[model samples]
Structures are given as structure tokens and as C-alpha cells.
Target: MDLFADDTRLTPMPIDDGELWFQQRLPLDLAPDEVMRRLLAETGWREEEIQVWGKLHKQPRLSAWHGEASYRYSGKTFHPQPFTALQLHIKQTVERVTGRRFNSVLLNYYRDERDSMGFHADDERELGPEPAIASVSFGAPRTFILKHRHLPKKVQLALGDGCLLLMAGALQKHWLHGINKERTPRGPRINLTFRLIL
Candidate 1:
């Protein structure tokens, strides 16, 4: 983990395919613990607290995005949850490192060993084609899996606390990714995925 660095540029994906570029690393100013605490306190999100689905309409999981009423599911709409100072700091750092401005972000809080996101692409219409997604992970380390859409190759990365991952280009078109909830003891994790919504 590149902890305590202000920001670091990452290796860009090879470009035989069209549409995608990215960078990943921990934000320079905040420590891992500080990021976690502020996220929990500001969101008023208790560990394992499940909110109504905000984006993915077809899934049995907890999710939140944009705080838009139209984006809500399960009878509860969130009014654009304000970003904490830590969130803004990280976002700025990401923008600097990736050289891309992100208008909106989607926050996914995975509590303990049960909360998990199923396989899917970040290919929403608002994301536009060849979307650039910069993901910053805090708290417990989790396995992020990527599988080819037509090919059989699968890749996995252990996202340690304060690790940053970037997915860009046609990676979304040719691949799908997700966090699986099997049977392993884990701590709370806050994932901030910065995106550009058209």
C-alpha cells in the first residue's frame, strides 16, 4: 500500500482496446484510520446498516449513490448525502492523480463478513462509454475479482486498506467485477468510487 503519500500516478492499461484510463493509490494527506472514522460518523452509517438500493435496480444488496430521490429504491430516497471532508480530500487527490474531474461518486459500505456486491460493470448510461472509475478502499482488505466477458481469464486483486484501483477503457465492456460474500470474518470497509456522470 502506498500509504501517506499525497498522490501517486499509476500504470495505464495497454490500449489495443478503446476507451479507458486510470490511476490508483492512497490519498496523501489522510491516514487509513482517519478516513474510516470520518466516513462512518458523517454517513451516520452503523456497521451492517442496510440502506435501500440506490442504483442497481435488480439486486439483493445494500447500495447508495448521488443521494438523488429518483435513484432510490425500497421506498426510501436519499437526499444527496453530503461528502465529509475526508471524502472531498480524497476526491481532489484522485482528480489530480488521474487527471480527470469526477462530478459524482458512489459510496458502498460493506459491513463485516456479510455485505457483498455481485458481479456487474460500472456501465451505467450516466457513466458514458469507456468510463474512468477511480476506486479508493479503506478499512479491511477485500478481494476484488475481474472476469472476462467472453474470454475465460479471471484476475483477482487484494485491496488492502488505503489501496486505490483504477478501471478504465474497454475493461468494462470485456470484463465484470464484484466483491463476494462467502464465509470469512472481516471488518467494515468503505469504498468510494469516483465517477463522471454525463
Candidate 2:
């Protein structure tokens, strides 16, 4: 499939040695709030622990893995759960907008101000060279931080409700991206990152 041929609405985000495209809103069958509510109730969510630097620590957020492939990260392997009807609908919508194919999805839920993820690259070997990752967010907005690996550069993106962010080309190899905990109270938010596992 020619993934980039028909994507006309995505705005390019500038960065060194990487590619990014952002759409303020994604096309969906249901309202973003309704979808968020369904996701909060129907999907299975897990609080996981990861080993870092010989120490085990619990992840600050709840997550679920879905689609055809299992995923491994942070010294743990996540077996896949078959996608729900709603999730499949979301996956299809994402595919249509991005014109990219994906066989797996990582769904993350941040309950409030205390949940966060540190800066990290998604350049796992199974993602192949130059994987295209599409991120779709629902609910409240949060800052997405990106930093260059070898340059004194940083970018902060406010990923709001129902938006789409596509990270492609050499983005994973050249930059680190993450979300930080907010000092003030924030509303619940959910993000889905779709990937094609090789």
C-alpha cells in the first residue's frame, strides 16, 4: 500500500533527522468522549511493572495490548488480546487517515496528573528500520515532548483530544519522545499508538 499518497490534511512538524505529521483531529465514527468512555469501561487494562537498571518499578499508567502480534518491551513480553469491535473501528479509521497498515496497538490510559512516561525511543528491532507509528489521542490534552539525541533541541506538542500524530521515517532513531506528569490536577486521557510488527 502507498501510505503517503493520499494523506492531504496532515501538517508537517519540523525536526532534524526525523519526520512527523500532525492532524488536529482524527476522523471517527463516534464522538471522542463517547469513545473514551467505552474504552474506559470495555477494554482490559493492566498496571505493569518493568525492570530498569536491575530494579523493578511499576509503570505509572495502565495499558493494554491488542491486535495480532505480541509485544516485548522494558524486559517484559505482552501477549496480544484480540481487538474489540470498537478498537477495530478505531484501527480502521486510523489506517484510513494515515494510509498505513498496522497489526498491533498499544493503548495507554493516564488516570490523572500523576501518570507519565519518561523519554524513550520506539526503535525496537521488531519494528524494523523506519517504522511508521500513528498515535491517536482521546480525552484531555497533554504535552508530548521530543528531544534530539545529539543536539540541544526540544519540541513540545500539546496532543489534544481526538488528534492524530504520525511519527515516521527515522524519527525513532534520532529522537526521544514522552509525556511528563503534571504538577496541577489534570483530566483523564487515553492514547493509542498503532504499529506494524515485522
Candidate 3:
């Protein structure tokens, strides 16, 4: 597939070493509030302890795994949960947009401003080289940060409700991305990242 196809809905980001496509809002028809409510009520959200620097600490946010393949991260293996109706619908829609097939999804639920994720790259072996990650956000808006691995350049964007961020090409190999904690008040937010696990 042509990575830089001239699509009216896709806005190419200005990053030197990677290809990113940003869409402020996706045409999912479902309201953001309704999606959040369904996910919260149906999905099994859990907090797992991760080992960092020889110490174990509880993850700041809730997470769930759903799809056909298992995922391993932070030295833990996550068995896949059967995809719910809502998840399957969203997955199909995203697949149509990116023209990519995804077999797994990792869902992160940020309860409030205090919940945050540290900077990290998604260049895991299972994802293969030049993996394409389709991220969809719902509910509260959060700032997404991407920093070049060896350069003094950074890209920051606010991912509001219903926004879709596609990270493809060599982005994960050359840059790191994360969502930082906010001091001010904010509502809950959910980020779903669909991936193809080889």
C-alpha cells in the first residue's frame, strides 16, 4: 500500500524520520460517551504490576487485551479476550481506513488526569519491522508526545475524543511516544491501539 496516498481525510504529520497520519475525528457514528460507557461496563479492566529498575510497581492505568493473538509486554504475557461487539465494529472500521489487517488490540483506560504512561517505543519483535499502529481515542482529550530517539526534535498533539492517530513506517523504530500525567482536572479517556502480531 502507498503510505502517502493523497486522501482527503488524512493529514500527514511533519516528522522527518517517520510517517504519521492524523485524523481529528473518525466517522464512527457512535457518540464518544456511549462508547466509553459500553467499554467501562463490559470490558474487564485490570491493573498489573510491572517491574522497572528491579522494582515492581502497579501500572497507573487500567488495561485490557482483546483479539486473536496473545501479547507480551513488560515481561508479562496477556492472553487475548474475545472481542466484544463494539470492539469488533471499531476494528473493522479502522481496518477499512488503513487498509491493514489487525489481529490484536491493546486497550488502555486513563481514569483521570493522574493516570499516565511513560515514554516507550512499540518496536517489539512480534510487530515486525515498520509496523503500523492505529490508535483511537475516546472521552477526555490528552496530549500525545513523540520524541526522536537521537535528535532534539519532538511532536506534540492533543488527541481529543474520537480522534484517530496512525503511526506507521519507521516511526516506532526512530521515535518514542507516550501520554504524560496532567495536573488539572480531566475526565476519563480510553485509547485503543490495534496491531498485527506476527
Q: Which is better, 1 or 2, measured by lDDT?
A: 2
CA RMSD of each candidate after superposition: 5.3, 4.2, 3.6
Model 3, 127-188: lDDT tens digits are 99999999999999999999899999888888888888899999999999999999999899
Clashes of each: 6, 0, 0
Q: Estimate each model's TM-score.
A: 0.77, 0.95, 0.94
lDDT tens per residue, model 1, 10-72:
654443343333334564687888888887777654222334454434333334564222332
- The models' CA-based lDDT, in order, is 0.67, 0.89, 0.88
Candidate 3 stretches greater than 4 Å from native: 1-8
The residue-level lDDT of candidate 1 at 140 comes to 90
**Candidate 1 vs 3: which has more TM-score:** 3
Give candidate 1's total backbone clashes. 6
Encode model 2's per-residue lDDT on 1-198: one tens digit a residue: 001212247777766798988888787878999999999998899999988888999999999999999889889999999999988999998898788999999999999989999889999999999999999999988999988999888888888888899999999999999999999899999999999999
Candidate 3: what lDDT? 0.88
Please give the lDDT score for candidate 1: 0.67
Worst 10 residues of 2 by lDDT: 1-10
Q: What's the lDDT for residue 73 in model 3?
A: 79
